[model samples]
Target: MHRTDNRHAPGASHNPRASQTHSGGSDTGHQSPGHQGAGHQARSVEAHRESVRELLADLAGTGRTEQLPLREALGRGLAADITAPVDLPPFANSQMDGFAVRSTDIPDGGTDLRVVAPIPAGAVAAPLQPGTAAPIMTGAMIPPGADAVVPIEKAVPDSFPRPGSTASVRLPATENGMYVRTAGSDVRAGEPALAGGTNLGPGQLGLLAALGITQVTVHRNLKVLLATTGDEVVEPGSPLEPGKIYDANGTLLEAAMRQAGLEVLRAAISTDNPEELTAMLRKHAPAVDLIVTTGGVSKGAYEVVRQAAGGQDIEFLHVAMQPGGPQGIGKFDGVPFVGFPGNPVSCLVSFEMFLRPVLSALFGAPAPRPAIRARLAEPVESPAGKHQVRRGTVLPDGTVRLEGGPGSHLVHALANSNALIHLPAGTSALAAGAEVEVWTL
Candidate 1:
C-alpha cells in the first residue's frame, strides 16, 4: 500500500474553519499565487508521506536492544539474528505412540517382537535388546539401537504391550527410519533460527520456547506521550456540562498506539490556554520518543496547539484529504510531534494514514492490513481535488456501502464501519459497481 497514485484519495473532509490560513479543503486542487510557481512545494499526499518517512528514518529504530523474558517479549521486534544453541528436538524422538525396534530385527515378512519395556512421554528408555521392542509414546526419546518405529495403530493387536509380562506387538514391515524424527531434522544447532526484524507473534514465540530460550533480545517498545487539547472536551466519567463533549480522541489514539505495540502515557486534557498547553509539552517532551496531540492545530482563535507550538519547528498544513486535513508535524524540544484534528473520526484517520505506516516501516511492529479493490454498492460524490476517505462496510458480494456523510464528527458511523473507502482526487462522483480502493480497518 506504499503507493503514490494521485488518483487515489483518502476520502475524508477537513473542517473549512481549520484550513482558512492556507487553501481551503474545497480548493485542494487550486494553486494559490504566493504558494505556486517555481518555489511551490508539492502538497500532494505522497509528498507529505515522503517527509514523514524521512523523519521516521532519522528518529526511529535507534538500534538499541533489551533482554526480556519470553513471556514479556511477545509482539516485540527481534533485535538481532538468533542462532539455535541446540538442534530442534535435540534428540531423536518418536512422532507417535508406537513400538521402537531395529528394522533388521523384524521378521522378513513382518511379524511381532518381544516387548521389553514401556517408555512414557518424558522417560528415558533403556536400550532395546536386539530381538525385543520398546513401547514409546509420542515425543519420548527413541531408545538407543532402535532405528524404526511402528505406530500403535499399525500393531497387529493394535494395543500397548505390557511393561513386565511376556508379550509381543505385531507390526507390518517398516523402513529403517520410519516414524522416527531425527535430531536436527527441523533445524541444526548453530544455525539461524530467526532473522533480525522478525515480529515475535504467537508462532515465533513458540519457536523460542521450543528452543528452551527463557530470555530474548528485542527492541524496546517506543514510548509515546499522548495529549488532547480543547476547552470543551471532558473526561468520559465526568458529568457533561452544557456545550461540553467527552474527550474521545485521547482514548482512541491511546488504544490505537498500544495495539500497534507502543507504550503510551496519556496526559490530562489541555485547556484552550496556550501557556498551559506549552507547559504540558515542555514537561513531558523529554520523557518520550514521540508526542501526539489532538485538537488545537486548526485556525480557530482558541487553537492552543497552534498558539503554543506555532513557534516550534512544526508545520501546520491542509493535506489534500477529507475529514482530517488539519495536520501538524515537526519536532519540539528534540522530540517528534504530530498534531491531529480534534474530531474523533479525524484523529483516528490521521493515525491510520500517517503514523501507523511509519511505525510499521521503522520497527516492524504492526503487520500491515490487507487492502482490497471493492466495487461501490452505491453512488457517492467527492471534492474534485482531495482524496476522500469514507467509512463503510464491505459486503459478501465484494461491494462496499458508505456508512455516513463526509463530516468528520461522525464517530458513531465510524464505529459501525470496518473499512475505509478511498475516492481518488479529480474524480467527483462514482456510481454503483465502480471499483475503488478499500483499506480494511
Candidate 2:
C-alpha cells in the first residue's frame, strides 16, 4: 500500500533490490543463512503480540456508534447506557384469573359478594361497588378501588357466572395487593435498563422489546481488508492446476474475523509479483481500518509481501513461536497491517494467539477462549528456543494427548483437536502426567 513506490505496480519491471531476501529470518524450523546475516533478531511471542496490540490501539475508544434494529443488534456491544422510557406494565394489572374486590369487604371468615361484571385482559372497568366482586382475567387492568384478587378456585363455585348475569360468590378474606402487579415494580420509568458495553443477547433483546424499544445504539463493527498471496494459491471450486492448492488462509481468516464481529473485505488472490500485491493493497487500504495478509513474509525468495513492504513503515520479523513464527506488523498507508504465515494451521494459530485476544480486549466481541490446566497424556519434546503450540484432544479425565506431530501444515490434525497445548519457550521436554496450560478451541 506504499503509494510512493510506483515501482511496485502490476506491470512495472522488478527491482533488483527486491530480490534480496527479507530480514524477517525464517519459519522453516531451522535458522536460515539469510537470517544469520540479516541482523533481524527473532522476538518473543509476547513481544510480537504486544506489537500488534499497539499497532491497532487507535481502534479502541473511537466512540463510533450505530443505530440498528433490535433483531440485528444481537451479539453487538451497547454503545451507551439504556434507560427505560416508561415503567414496566405501565399500570397495575391482574396476576390471576379471579375476581377483583376490596380486601376489607370480606369478613375474617368469609363473605358473599355480588358479581357485577367480567373484566377480561385489556378491558377498563369501573370501580368496584362496596360489596360486589368483578370477575377478571389474568393480565387485565385492575379496576379503580380494587385492592386484592380472589382466585376463581377460592370461590364457592370455582368458576365465573355467565356474562351480564347477576350472581353471588363466596370468597375468603385476602390482604391488600395480593395477586396484583403494581406499576413500576419491575423497572421504573427513566431508570437504567441496561449498562453500556453489555453484549446484546436473547435476554437483552427481550428486555428491550418489553421496554418498547424497536432499535438500539451499539458500537460499529470494525472493518478489515484481508488478502492472501502466492501464485500457487487458487480459490476453491476451480479446476486444480499443476502444483496449485485451494486458498484456505483467506476463508479461514475471514471466518475468524467475522466471528470477532469484524466486517471483512477480502481482496483477490495476489500472485508472486510484488507489484500486483502492492497495487491490490493500495486499492483497498482506504476502505478498511486494518489490513491482514497471509503468506509472503518468510525468508523465501518469492516472498512478494516482504518485497512489496520493502522501504515501507511495515516491519517483517520472526516471533519465537512454533507453527506460526514469521509475522509482519506495522502500518500500510496509515492503516494497521498484520501479515501472518502461509500454512493453514499457522495462519489460524496466528489469529488465535495474537489477533483474537487483541480484538476481545479492544472491541469486547468473540469472548475469550477458555484456558485451563490439563495433564499431559504422553511425554513430548519441543524446540529449545521457540514456543510450541500443539493440537490436542483434552480427554474427560483431564489429560490431553497430541492430535498430530508439530508440523505447520497439519490441517487434518488441527481439525480433530479440541484444544491448544501451550508449551512455553525454553521448555525442551515434558513428562507424561505433567500439568500444562491449555486453551480450549
Candidate 3:
C-alpha cells in the first residue's frame, strides 16, 4: 500500500510565497525555458531540502549494523566507538638503527662503548651490560637498562659491526629516551581509536590493521533502486537511432550515488509508458530502502513519472531553482521515492543539492562536499526568482569563471568545472570580482 506522511509531503499546495531572504524579482534571466510554468507556484529550495531530510530521517535510527572485514569496511560508517585494545607499538622500540645504550654511559665530550650482541627487529634483547651498547635495528625492542638510541650515522664507524665481533664505537652524548618509540605514545590502551559515525577510509583501515583489528562493526549501507526514464534514451555502445540519445543519466546518477557510498540497484531503462514505469518501480520497490527515478517529474504532456505516480502519493512540484526546478518526493508503495529531472546536468545538480546532503547527515558515509566562497572572474546574470547553480572553474588566484552558459543540458561544461557557483534566488546579476558561495565538486 502506498502511504503519504504529511510531514514528508511538500506538495500539499502550490505556495508561491518564495522566501524573501534571497534576492528576488521576476524569473527572467537564467531560468530554463522548458521548466517555466505560468500558473503553478514554486517552493523555496530550503523547503524542499527540509522535505527531503524529513523523508530520509528514519534511516539514521534503523540501528542496523554489520560486522565486516577491515578491507570490506572501507567507506562504511562506524557503528560504535573503537577503543585501542593494546598500546600502540606495544613496547618500547628503537626509532633508529644504531646503538641502544645508557645515556649516562656517554660523556659530555663523547665516549666509546663496547658493543654487545646485535638486536634486530622482532628480537628480544638481553639487558645491556652497564657500560656496553647494543646494535639495534629500527623497530627492535629497546634493551632493558638502555635509555637512549644513537643513530648509526652518529656512530664514529657509522655502521654496525659484524655480529659477535667485539667492537667499540665512539658515540655522542644523548638524552634519555632519545630516538625511542615508547609504548602507548601513538595511542594508549583503552583510548578511543575511532569514534562512532566515523567514515572508514584508507587511513582508518590502516590504523585498525596496525591495532591488530581484523574486523569492524559499521552501519549497513543504504540500498537504493535507481531508475532512469525517457523514450528517447538508449544504452551506450549501441547504434544511436536518429532521434535518440544515449542514456547518460543512468550512468551519471549511478556514479554519483556510488561515490556517495550508496548501494545502487540500477533498474533497466524504462520507456515513456506510465504503466511500464510503475510496474518496474513496484517490482524493485520491495528490495530497496529508497527509489530514485530520473526524467519524468515535469508537467509536460508526456510526463510518465507524474502520470504513473499521480495516485501513489508522489507530489510533483517545481522548486525555485534553475536547472533542477522540477522535483517529486513522497512514498511509492510504502517506499521512499525521489523523482529527478531527465536532463543530465539537472539530474546531477538535483542529487547534489537535495539527496547528497541528506545522505551525509543521515548515514555519515560520504562526508559533505565543502562549500566555500570565491570571487567571480566575470559578470554573470541569474534568474530573478530562482536560485542559480552554475558550473564554474576556480582560478589559481581564487576567482571562479563560468564553465558554460546556464543551460540544463550543458553536461560537457559540468565535466570541465570544479565547483558549483551559487547565486541565491533574489540575485539577478553580479559584476566580476563579486564574492559568491561555491560548492567544491
Q: Of the candidates numbered 1 and 2, which has the greater lDDT value? A: 2
Which segments of model 2 are wrong by more than 4 Å? 1-54, 60-64, 99-116, 128-133, 146-157, 168-179, 237-243, 298-303, 316-323, 364-406, 416-441
Ten-residue region with minimum lDDT total, candidate 3: 17-26
lDDT of each: 0.77, 0.80, 0.81
Q: Which candidate wins on TM-score?
A: 3
For candidate 1, the TM-score is: 0.80
| TM-score against truth, every candidate | 0.80, 0.71, 0.82
- Candidate 2 has which clashing residue pairs, if any? 8-275
List the candidate 3 regions with Cα displacement exceeding 4 Å: 1-47, 61-63, 231-246, 271-273, 300-302, 370-376, 384-386, 394-400, 424-441
lDDT of 2 by residue, 177-293 (tens): 999999998899999999876778899999999999999988788899999887778899999887677887888889888988899999998988998888899999999989999
* TM-score of predicted structure 3: 0.82
Per-residue alpha-carbon lDDT of candidate 1 for residues 1-441, written as tens digits (9 for 90 to 100): 222332212223334334322111222323222231233322466666666777667554546668999999888878778899899989999998989999988776888788887888878778888988888999999999999998999888989855688987777888899999999998889999998778888899999999989998887777899998877778999998876778788888999999999899999988888899899999999898889988876655566787898579887765666666667788988788888877777778878888887777666677566789999999988866666789999999999999988777777888999999988766688999999999998
Lowest summed lDDT across 10 adjacent residues in model 1 is found at 20-29
lDDT of 3 by residue, 199-285 (tens): 888999999999999999887888999998877778889898776778888889999999998899999989888899889999989
Give residue 243's lDDT in candidate 2 (0 to 100): 69
